[model samples]
Target: MLKSTFLSVACCLFIGHHAFTQCIAGGSNAVAPYASNSSNKGVMFDITATNTVTISCFDANLPALSVGGYEVYFKTGTYVGFETNAASWTLLGSEGSLLSIGLNLATPISVPVNKTILAGQTYAFYITASNPILSTGVLTTTNSGYSAITSNSDLTVYGGAGITYPFGTVTANRAFNGTVHYILGDPLPVEFLDFTAVKVDQSVLLEWETESEHHSDYFEVERSLNGIDWNRLLTVKGAGESSVKEIYQKMDDNPLDGISYYRLNQYDFDGTKTSLKTISFNNKVEIGENDIRIFPNPIIDRFRVFGNQSELETLKVFNSVGEDISGSLTMTCHEGFTDVVFKDQVEGVFILKSKTNSQILIKK
Candidate 1:
């Protein structure tokens, strides 16, 4: 047995035969009585079915004046005819011919079909009343199941062309360091969001949380040395819904000597893609003349400095804005290496300047 469904007709009004509005279910519009010219009005029906169905239009006015002079078409194809039930379709209200009728009346009509439908098939019904002069009236119509054993199906109605239905899902899992680190889901369209990054020991960690998603397909993590030409580092999926959260993370083990920029490329399921806001990082780890080393370079918590010499003197750390963070000379440059530790400082870019009289170390 097929599923039960209902289709209700809504009335709409047009004035002066100039402007047009949508004709929804359970709506009505008032128009002034006309004498000669008949105006054109219509309602479109979108149906998704698996078997043939019947469409009927009815109003308060019947027999005296019937709905005959109108055009009907299917959005996906063409309408064959009104079928055998067309004549039996009922109408109510007093009516008369165009030459004799002076009072305003309502008319209704119906069209039935017996064609077979397939699963997931979509079809549309359009009814239009066209006349050269002024013909102002109301049209009411309904669609009902004619075949007894029709397949159980559903029909999604749309207002106009190019409208898309929201039918997607997304899921995320895995959390680390008090934050979610993994995500996967359907592709969504384009939108806006925020991303953040942090430096942990020798590895730079990236994390981004999403509040909502739409037609978003996936995201590509990109990295750049000079904030210019970027290369993709990783790809993350999107959640195609609202009121959901998605988290993504990636680690860049090898940071540049100066600064690095990162961005995300959000792609849609339809091949449409856009880039997110770019973030820059000023890495103070540099290779010097005596040895390649990194000091408390703006080291908020703790950091270690390394060099290729066995002798050392003083280690000075300054913030990226040239503010002195710490100055220390307690270093035993053994095997050309030493680690300086600074505790409880703000996280930001900094410069480490080290000197051994005969050898000087500078990192920005």
Candidate 2:
């Protein structure tokens, strides 16, 4: 009787171990609107650890009788180009021998192990067919429940080819791409619900709220005068770990004379840090100068001049005393953003002249 009991327990342990090792693939149940059109598009996710990152499972939609592998890469910028070029890339991992595929089937193909990644830097990962001869599976796409931080990374894609036609950054409302499952980095500790900055008299007030916190240590408030040079202002305690909403606020008693930038950094108990988005505030400034949107209002040498491309022809800047400053105005337009760059400009208020309108632009 004793021997039989011991054998039964051993058999149960073996079965459990075998089941855990198998990879289960997943994808959208029905046809979705998004599809992986080409190799120049992928999802961008930040590596949460410094030691090593592992891609647990890879899922894809393949054609019938497909047999090939994928080459995974880590890139800095868009899906392709100098940033995605071989000179500036880190080969994370690769896998082969993915065989016996069916028509339009979404399944977990392979699991590659340890690839080194930085702790706090942003990275984009893409998968390409190992060989061009065989049919390959692309990351099937979808777009639901994509608002929060989930297993899905932000979907970024590129459309152009070669050195001349650059694949500009275009964020689409689609996810459910390759490798939906990850056993690599730790989960994001805090989910920010809302973050806003308001100017109250001489001081600026910074406020933010989080939906949940896990193993969170504290919040470090950083201030910047030019949005480039940052300085630590204060630290506020977090909820440690909670599922309820938590509200936090900090006052910048010594806001700069003009415009200032504020950003939040959340730290975990184990020294893991994540940066929240940045916001700007102006102490004594106009909300919208003459019904024109002049952001970072108290400009720090650089600001954008937004206007409908067809409606506006030329953008010029003049000093506070109505003198056109001696400098070059470079304007670049892409993806509906027109940035007016200024060179050799001094601090103070100015006027931005467009074809049909003029706005007061303050420089700090």
Candidate 3:
């Protein structure tokens, strides 16, 4: 991203536009540095992908601040485009002696490659400027000579020959022709330090660390029983912007039996999402006698286990009337209820067995 010190100005300008108020110069002028009160000028051209355009601007002795930079707004029509199409660049202040302050009437400004543009699209490029003292300077637009001015302040008509003053007067020989360019953004915003998943007793522990993050919003921890159908377990808030290493962890208390897969989905503040590599861990733990108890016999698709189950580990479901069914058991506890979900189990009576207790569960 091409960042500049004029970010605050751009933000304020965009916000003011939202309020339906136009920023005007001292009196009736649309804005200083800009010539026409109508906010349109003569001549426009199209710039293609990754191409470069040179714009001309001059800082003459004016009431505005003498130093600092300005903003550039580009769009396909006479109307300004979205805020994303706007960019700010640096401007050279008056540097020479007093007599030669306005000597450089046409300063060349180049559109950087980082600024993106659509291919095969025509755009009207213009400047929205403010000097160091927040006053508009007498800056002139640099020209590329792609079109001639048909009339002043009438960008809809062009190709005669002459320059038009901002106040809408046509001169015999002057034109404003600035080039527009296009380029793609080429940079990664996040760097991962480490990501790992481990089996912690009856639960799965997922931990990931990022070396640095930019515009990060949050991380979604996704769990999968078969690595095909994934479910979001939790979303951890991220540091909006960070340069230092950040560590995050998520505990999947209700992980599927045998093997459970986990991955991290990072979302940027701009809504861009990226997924980290998936990791699988065996979540099956050996069942042993403990102090937990399952209750409410003849259960439905689910059942609960309670009573001193805080220390209980392994849980499994079995067919009470036939051979051990080919189903996976997943468990999670909350509010004194250990939720047991059976995958691939048919409707019938089943055995819900934990480290400490067993109960007859009915699936209807």
Candidate 4:
């Protein structure tokens, strides 16, 4: 959810002939107290084992910045260098609803790296935001790596911070702070897309589609009041081994009153499971449902919300399509009012908002 300081040394790995869990480097993983003053950042490393590595989860360290969120991307190979943006890179999903700086290495950020790196291949990754995060208009991966530092026999971490997708010019080898958590196995056989949860009347409807799958057994639908604790609601049969798109759905007939978090996990025939992605849905508005509203019903650029300081702080907005687009919107707060703006502007779209105490606002 946040971050920590990291120690720069060599790559260390824990291995098993079949499957074992290990991290990217050997040193203690955390954030650096200072910034390298670089552009976008990521990690570059090489795995030597014949067995592939599955990137489970990873965390980043921003020495002195609190960000709205981070848009993360990953690519295979040992990082070619100098990137402008993530136009060409593959998406590993996003991390941190609001990635802030702190000291928490025990928890891996939720930028689900459900990707598998081929045997004896290299890999690269980076995290970025719409705006600079460091105090000096920079975002850091922290300083916790070195050039050709072999942490063990199975893996070799190359160089310090690997600069990625620079907005301005370029800066390389700034030491990638934080560590990448990997599993000693191949990627999941099945691939999925568009996992969504929507409030359908009094219950919640969960739906997801798969592009391809092989040796897959079934999918587990789990729900949580908070994102931490999860309970398995039901299991749906998988496509087994299909090449076309497969659709699946589940119903949470007893969802929480306000916000409910839903997570999707797929299990293989051999019982190997991979956690896909987590999304949230607002069941209903409990209070202030009629009084809550946004100005300029059909906003062109921006809108205003009149509320106290506390109400403004807890405000969250979703699109008509039901995605948690809160992090995509910007906020400017005054004493008794707050200005809201969506960066990716579009016309004729509606917005759904949820504020403190289940207050709801719907605007076209």
lDDT preference between candidates 1 and 4, better one:
4
Candidate 3, residues 243-274: lDDT per residue as tens digits? Answer: 87577867777767666667667898888886
**Predicted structure 4: clash tally:** 12
RMSD of each: 30.5, 24.5, 26.2, 14.7
lDDT of 2 by residue, 320-342 (tens): 67776524554554332344555
lDDT tens digits, residue span 265-294, model 1: 778778786555456665663334444333
Error (Å) of candidate 1 at residue 266 is 0.6
* Comparing 2 and 4 on TM-score, the stronger one: 4
Pick the lDDT winner.
4
CA error at residue 62 for candidate 2, angstroms: 28
Top-down TM-score ranking? 4, 2, 3, 1
Q: Which regions of candidate 3 deviate over 4 angstroms?
A: 1-187, 285-364
Point to the candidate with the largest TM-score.
4
User: Which 10 successive residues of model 4 have the least lDDT summed?
Assistant: 11-20
TM-score to native of every candidate shown: 0.27, 0.33, 0.29, 0.55
Of the candidates numbered 1 and 2, which has the greater lDDT value?
2
